[model samples]
Target chain A: MRRFAALVRRDLRLSLRAGTDATTAVMFFVVTVALFPLAIGPESTVLARIAAGVIWVAALLASLLSLERLFANDYEDGGLDLLALSPLPLEAAALAKVAAHWLVTGVPLILAAPVLALLLDMPAGGFAVLMASLALGTPSLSLIGAAGAALTLGARRGGVLLSLLVLPLFVPVLIFGAGAIDAALHGVAARPHLLLLGGFLAAALPLAPIAAAAAIRQALS
Target chain B: MALPDRMAYLTVAMHRFANPARFQRIATAILPWSAGLTVLLLAAGLYLGLVASPADYQQGDTVRIMYIHVPSAWMALFIYANMALASAVGFVWRHPLADLFCRAVAPVGAGFTAVCLITGSLWGEPMWGTWWVWDARLTSVLILFFLYLGYIALVNAFDDPVRGLKAGAILVLVGVVNLPIIKFSVDWWNTLHQPASVSRLGRPALDPAMLTPLMVMAAAFMAYFVTLALLRTRAELLNRRIQVLQMARGAS
Candidate 1:
């Protein structure tokens, strides 16, 4: 347990020191959302109308961009082989990596979303839903992306391969995340979508670690 | 042997081909038979479905689309299921044949899915008054198509084929879990698409006339799938043998 905690801390420190994952994701999220107003001609109504989709999609892409590094670097440097041999179960190590990934990527994206949301002209009412949905949704993204990242650990042209493998699965999260905010904007209950998002998170939390561990083990083998 | 005893004998005979060399021999012998069977069955099915069967009172000739559309859709789902089952076997038992089964089935499944989407659009044009809608079933099938592509991509993405197969197996299993959700997404939520008919319990809502060609076409496709899977598996085995020979020569 202490070893796992140390591994998580080590990863967090590595991510924080590099600063590429969180910074680049935030920059992409802001720049992409910023482009929407320019392309759609700065109409607040039009911007507000499409803001939910724009924000959700930009966040999706940003999350996807940083996904390749999740295990690719570790695998290349033989860190993954070490993890596999550790006293901590490979699944625990997988979870720790994903947690560190979420800290570096998912959390920063969520925190930066409100600023991006303003630039997208999302109504004040939708801000809370946007933040809430992403708060739930991005961790699910991290978990699913971890599975994809592990699966494509040493593949040729892995970035495109990872997106192709991961995006179809990400559709549900995008649907519910955007739908939750869209529902709230229309004065409807967003609870069902939120609940479904939670269900997905619960499912991914346990299942992804196992799948990722298996993929890593296979890659190492 | 009695009838039941003969059936058991046949199953064991089939399982004999589960050995790669035995499968190669059987596939070589049976390819002509399966090809002939597929042609005969498909021709009969198309004639009966497109010409002999009466038009629907409601959908008119447009309902004819169901004959092709239904079977291809069934094939799409069936092939993916086969891939998933094979993948699980490969992952759990580490069977080389199971890996071959997954690799062999993915492209065939993707082809069936592509046919499903195209025929569905053809059916929709005259019936639904649009080329497409974001209906749950349609979207799910589309996702299945992408899953097949992803599987194929991952399976070929590695320098070593074994690595690719292992990665691809993980993907297939993940997709299988999502299949049920995709199938039921329409029923559970509001969507433009209709709910289950052929898959549901009790009497299928389809008429007997419509069901006949659909079933025959479906059977023909299944036979075709088996034939193709056999052919592909043989080809993969041969490819492996050639690689082994090349490596041996280089080492020597």
Candidate 2:
């Protein structure tokens, strides 16, 4: 348990020092959201309808761009080999890494989403749904992206390959995340989609780490 | 063995081919039979489906697309299930052939899935009045197709073939669990799409006439996949052996 926290803290500290990952994801999110208005000619209604999708897609992309860093740095520098030899279990190590990843990249994306939502003229009623959905959704992204990241550790063209592998898996989260906002926009119940999004997060939390650990183990082997 | 025990014997025969040399021999011997069966069954299915099968009063002759679309979709799901099961066998039994089966199965599965998706979209354009819908079934199947592509790509992505196979096997197992969820997501939700027909809990809602050719086409596709998978796996095994022999010669 102490090891897990130490690993998480260590990762957080490293990510903070590196700094570029979080900033790039948020900037990409902002730029992608900002581009829509230019591309679509400033029709607030048009923007409003697509706000949830655009935000979710950008968030998805932002999360993906930072994923290669999840295991690549550690694996390349022999840090992963030491981790494998540690007393800590591989699954726990994976969970800690994914948690740290989520904390740095995912949380910022969530924080930045409302601002982008506002820029896109998203309905006021949808704010809570947006926040709640991202809260539940992004961890799944981190975890799922961890598996892709681990699998692609030394592969060529891994960036494009990672997106192909991870994005399809992200569909359910995108569906329910955007569905929650769409529900709120229509003055209907957003709770169901939000709940399903939560369900996805819960299932992914345990499953993704185990899968990621296996892939990482394979990569190390 | 008695005549009634033939299938059990066949299963044993299939299992024996689980060995690479034996597999190569069996596949070589059966490849012609498989191709012959595929051609025969497909021809019969197409004839029965396209010409002999009656047009739907509601959908007209355009319903012929169902023959192709439904079978491909079934193969898509079945092929994934096969890959997942083979992956499990590889993971648990650590069978070399199981890994080979998974490696061989992915492309064929992806091809079938692509066919399913394309036919579905084409069918949808006329029926649903749109080429695409975010309908749960359609979306899930699209994701399933992507999963196959992902599995295929990941399997080949690694420089070390062993690493790629192991990683790809893990992915297949993960995806297997998602398949039922994907198939049922539409039925579970108040979605725009209709509920599952043949796979539903109660008696299948499809017409008897529609059911017949659909079953025949499904059988033909299964035969086609089996034939092709065997051939591919055999070729892969031979390729690996050749590489090992080449390396050994170079070492000497």
Candidate 3:
């Protein structure tokens, strides 16, 4: 457990020191969300109606933008080979990385979403639901993105391939996350949608790391 | 023979065909049969589906689109399941041909999925009064189509073919979780798409006239997949041989 925490701290420190990945991702999220009003026209009704979908889709793409660095950096510098030889299991190491990624990327995106939601004039009732949905949903995105990053570790055009590999998997999260806000907008209880997101997170939490670990091992081999 | 001996014998039998040389011999022998079956079934199916079957009471000739759409949809799911199973076998057992089979199946599966989507859209325009709907079934199938494209793209992205194969295999396994969701999305979500008419309790609700042609067309598509897979796997094996020979010549 201590080792896991240390690994997480190390990754967090590394990402913070580099100071580009998380910031770029959040900026991309904001810029992507900002573009919707321009593209769809500056009408409040139009923006409010599609705000959840626009925010969720932009966040999904933003999360994907930084995923290439998730394992490629370690794989390139021989750090991954050493990590595979470490006392900590590779699966736990993967989980630590995913946790750190979510901390830097997912949390910031979640924080920024409500602020951007205002640009779209989202209803006041949707703020809590959107935040809750992102809170529950973004971890799965990081977890699944880790597997995608691991799988594409040594591939050519990895950024493009990663999007292809990960985006379809992102559909369920997008559906439930955006669905929750849609339900709130229509005065329906968003509980079911939120719970479904939670369920996806629960299932993805343990399973994704194992898959990622296997892919990392394959890449190192 | 005892259980362990029997298992050993079975493994040997399986491994015999795992060799590329041996697989080529067998594939050549069966290719003609599969090709013949494919042509025969397709001819018979087209005849039955396009000519023999009567038009739907409500849909008129447009119902014939279901003949192509349904079978292509079935093949899309079938090929994905097969690909996933092959990946699992390759990952656990390291079967030499499993990865080859996976690479061979992906594009053909994608083609079938594309056909399914295009025909489905054509059918939907006349019936549903739109080119597309965000209903559960259509959305899930669209996702399946993307999964096929992803698998194909991943499998070819690495300069090291072996690494690409292994990576693609891992992805195949990860994507298997979506299969069940796609299968059941209609039941779980209240959507515009109709629920399962073929695989429900007891007998299928489809009329006999429609059902017969559908079955024939499905058989044709299955035969087509088998024929193409064998041919493609053979080509892949030959390509690998050429790569090995080129490396050997370069070293010399």
Candidate 4:
């Protein structure tokens, strides 16, 4: 247990020291959302109509910006073999890496989403649901992206291939996350959509790590 | 023989042909039969589907596209399920044939999915009055196509063949589990495709005249899939042999 915490702390410390993942993700999130209004039209009504989709998609893409770094450095430097051979189970280590990734990139994107939502003229009533859905949705993105990152650990053109592998899998999270906010904006209950997002997170939590660990093991072997 | 003994006997019989050489002989024997069946069934299926089947009162001739569209869609899903099963087998038993089968079948599955999509679009422009819609089933099938592409790309991405196959097996398994969640979430978000499961319990609520062509086309598609899969696996096996020979010559 201590080792698990230490591993997560090590990853967090690495990211903080690099000072890139969180900043780049948040900056990417804001910039991408900003572009939507410019491209679609600056009309507040049009912006408001697409606010949820724009925010969710931008956050999803922003999360992707830093995903390749999740295990690439570790795998390249032989640290992944140590992790595999350590007392901690590979699956637990996989979870730790993904958790650290979520804390670093996913949370920042979530935090930036509300401000971008406002910039895009999202209605006031949708803010709470938007935050809640992001809270539930972004972790699923991290979990899913971790597997993609691990699968592409040593591949040529790994980043582009990672997105190709990961985005179709991201469709559900995008749907439910955007749907929940859309429900709230339309004065409907967001509960069902939020619950489904939670369900996706639950399914992804255990399964994605196993897949990531398997891919890591495959890479090392 | 006792049931357990009979099962054991069957296992030995199958594993005896697990050797690439023995598998080749069997594949060669089955190839001609499958190819013949594919040609005969396809010819019969096309005649029935394109010429004999009644035009829908509403759809006219465009109803005929479903004959190609639905069967390819069925094969696309079927081959995915088959690959998932093969991956699990390869993972658990470390069977070379299972990995080879996955590599062999992915392109075939992707081809079926492509046909399903294009044929679907052709049908939709006439029926749904758009070339496409973000409907639940349409989106799910499109995702399935992407999954096939991802698997094939990952399987070929590595310098080491074994590593690539192992990575792809993990992906295939992951995808099979996620397939339902994706299907359900999209259904919840919006449903434009017909709920198809409701029709599976009995004969699919089609006129017997129309159902025959659909069934024959489905059979033809299955035979075509079997023939192609066998041929591809044989090619993969032969390619591996050539690689082994080349490496041996270089080392010598």
Candidate 5:
């Protein structure tokens, strides 16, 4: 447990010191959201109708942008080899990296979503549901994205390949996360959508780490 | 062997054919039969599907698209299942031919999926009043197509062929979880796509006249896949042999 925490802290500090990953992701999120108004015009109803979908998509893309560096840096510098040789289980190590990634990228994207939602003229009723869905959903994105990152390590055109591997898997999260807001806006119960998001997170949390660990082992081999 | 031991024997028998030489011999012997069956069934199916069957009272000739669409859709799912099962065997048992099966089946599966989507769209244009709908079945099948593409890309991505195969095997296992979700998405969502007609618990809702042609076409497609996969796997093995020979020559 201590070793896992230490790994998470080490990743956090490394990302923080380098500083561009989180900021770039957040900035990308903001810029992508900002483009919607310009491209679609400032028509309130049109923007309102698409607000949930736009936010969810932009968040997904922003998280994807930061995913390439998740295992690349460590794998390149031989840090991954030492980690694999460590006494701690590689699954736990994978989980720690995913958690740290969620903290830096997912959290900021969640925090930034509501502000972007406002620009889309999203209903007042949707704010809480939007945040809640993203809060529940983004961790799964980071977890699943970690698996993609591990799978593509040292592969040619890895960044593009990672998106190809990861984006289709992101559909369920997009459906439920955006569905929650859509439900809330229509004065319907958002609970089912939120519950589904939770269900996905619960399933992904345990399974993704195991898959990522296997991929990492293959990469190292 | 006793009943419990029978399964073990079968597994052992299956593994015995994992040797490239043994597999090549068996594949070569079966290829002609498989190719003949594919041609004969396809000819019979197309004649029955296009000419022998009466047009649908409601859908008219557009119903003919279902002959191609349904079978291709079935093959798409079937091939993915085969790939996943083969990948699991490769990973756990280290069977050499299991990964080869995965590599050979992927593009064939993708082609089937594409046929399903394109024919579906053509049928929808006349029947559903649109080229496409966000129907849960169509959407999930589209996702399945993407999964095949991802598998193919991952299998060729690495400089080391063995590493690529291992990585692709893991991915196939991961993507298998999506299969159940895709199969059930229509039932859960109640979208624009028709509910299950053929695979339900009771007898299939399809009429025998319509059903026979569909079954024939499905058999033809299955044979087609088997014939192509065997040929592809044999080619892959030959490629590996040539590469080894070239490397040995360079060293000498």
Candidate 6:
């Protein structure tokens, strides 16, 4: 457990010092959200109706930005070999890396969501659920994206391939995340959507790491 | 025989049969039969479906699309399940044939899925009054099409053939596990689709006349899959051999 925490902290420190993980994803989120108004016209009603969906999609794409590099830096430099040889199991190592990723990129995206939501004229009622659903959903995105990153470590066209591999898997999260906020905006209970989002996170937490670890091992081999 | 000798013999036998030589020979024998069955069943199914089967009272002749659409959808799901199961087998045993089967059958599965989607759209335009709807079943099947494309791309993306096979196997297993979750969540998110009306577990509510051709078409699709899979696996085996030869020549 100590080793796992250390891995997470180490990743967090490195990414923070580099200022890449958090900034890139957050900036992409902002740019993507900012495009909608220009593209769809500044009609507040149009933005209001699509606000939840647009925010969720941009967050999804933003989380995808830093994914391919998740394992690339370490794998290329022999760090992954040491991790595989460590006393800490590689699955736990994978989970720790994904946790750090969620903290840096995913949390920032969640934090920036409400600002974008407001810019799009989303109702105040949706603010809480937007953040709540992102909190639950974004970890799953990072975890699944990490698995795609590991799978594509040395593959050709890694970036495009990673998106294809990861985006389809992101469907449920997008559905429920947007659904939860849409529910709140319309005065419906968001409980069921939140619960489903939680369920997705719960499933992704254990399963994705194992998959990522397996892919990592295969890449290393 | 001594224990060690027997074990050695067993291993050799296992490998011999596991190798594609034996498989090729077997496939060679069965291909004609499978091809014949495919052709026969398809002709029979088309005749019965397009001619013998009565037009639906509500949908009229347009309902005949189900004869093609339903079976293609069934094959799409069926092929994915087979790939998933084979992927697990390959992952556990490192079975070369299982890996080959998954790779060989991917395009076939993807083709079936695409057909399913296209026919569904064609049917939807007539029945649902639109070429598309965000309906749950439609969405899940569309996702299945994407999954197929992803698998095929991943299989070829790696520089190393072995790594490509292994990674593809892992991905298909992951996808199969998520298939149910995606389906359920999509269903939960919104449901404006019809319930399963026919060809269900207890008794299909379908007309007896329609059932015959649908079953025949399904059998025909299965046979078509077997024939194509065998032929493709043979090609893959040959491709691997050619790669080995080219590398060996390079080394020389």
Candidate number of the best DockQ: 3
Candidate 3 versus the native: TM-score? 0.97
Runs in model 1 deviating more than 4 A are B1-18, B25-33
Show the colliding residue pairs in model 3: none
lDDT of 1 by residue, A126-199 (tens): 88989999999999999999999999988999999999999999989999999999999999999999999999
Candidate 6 lDDT: 0.90
Local accuracy of candidate 5 as per-residue lDDT tens digits, A1-221: 99999999999999999999999999999999999999999999999999999999999999999899999999999999999999889999999999999999999999999899988999888999999999999999999999999999999999999999999899989999999999999999999999999999999999999999999998998
Per model, kept true contacts as a fraction are 0.84, 0.78, 1.00, 0.62, 0.76, 0.70
- Per residue, candidate 6 scores C-alpha lDDT tens digits across B29-48 of 99999999999999999999
Report the lDDT tens digits of candidate 6 across residue range A1-221: 99999999999999999997899899999999999999999999999999999999999999999998999999999999999999999999999999999999998888898899999999888999999999999999998899899999899999999999999889989999999999998899999999989998898899999999999999999
**DockQ for all models, in order?**
0.80, 0.66, 0.91, 0.75, 0.83, 0.81
Question: What's candidate 4's DockQ score?
Answer: 0.75
- Cα deviation at A149, candidate 4, in Å, is 1.1
| lDDT string, candidate 1, B60-128, tens digits | 998888888888888888888888888886776677878888898889999999999999998888888
Candidate 2 chain B has its poorest 10 consecutive residues by lDDT at B10-19
TM-score of predicted model 4? Answer: 0.95
* Angstrom error at residue B233, model 3: 0.8
Q: Model 2, residue B43: what's the lDDT?
A: 96
Error in Å for residue B164 of model 5:
1.3
Q: What is the DockQ ranking, best to worst?
A: 3, 5, 6, 1, 4, 2
TM-score of each: 0.94, 0.93, 0.97, 0.95, 0.97, 0.95
Q: Which portions of model 6 show Cα errors greater than 4 Å?
A: B1-17, B181-190
Q: Candidate 3 regions off by >4 Å? A: B1-13
Model 4 chain A is weakest, by summed lDDT over 10 consecutive residues, at: A106-115
Please provide, for model 5 over B124-184, each residue's C-alpha lDDT reduced to its tens digit, 9 standing for 90 to 100.
Answer: 9999899999877898899999999999999899987778888899888888877988788
lDDT of 3 by residue, A1-221 (tens): 99899999999999999999889999999999898898889989999999999999999999988889999998989999988999999999999999999999999999999899988999989999999999999999999999999999988999999999999999999999999999999999999999999999999999999999999999999
Ranking by lDDT: 5, 3, 6, 4, 2, 1
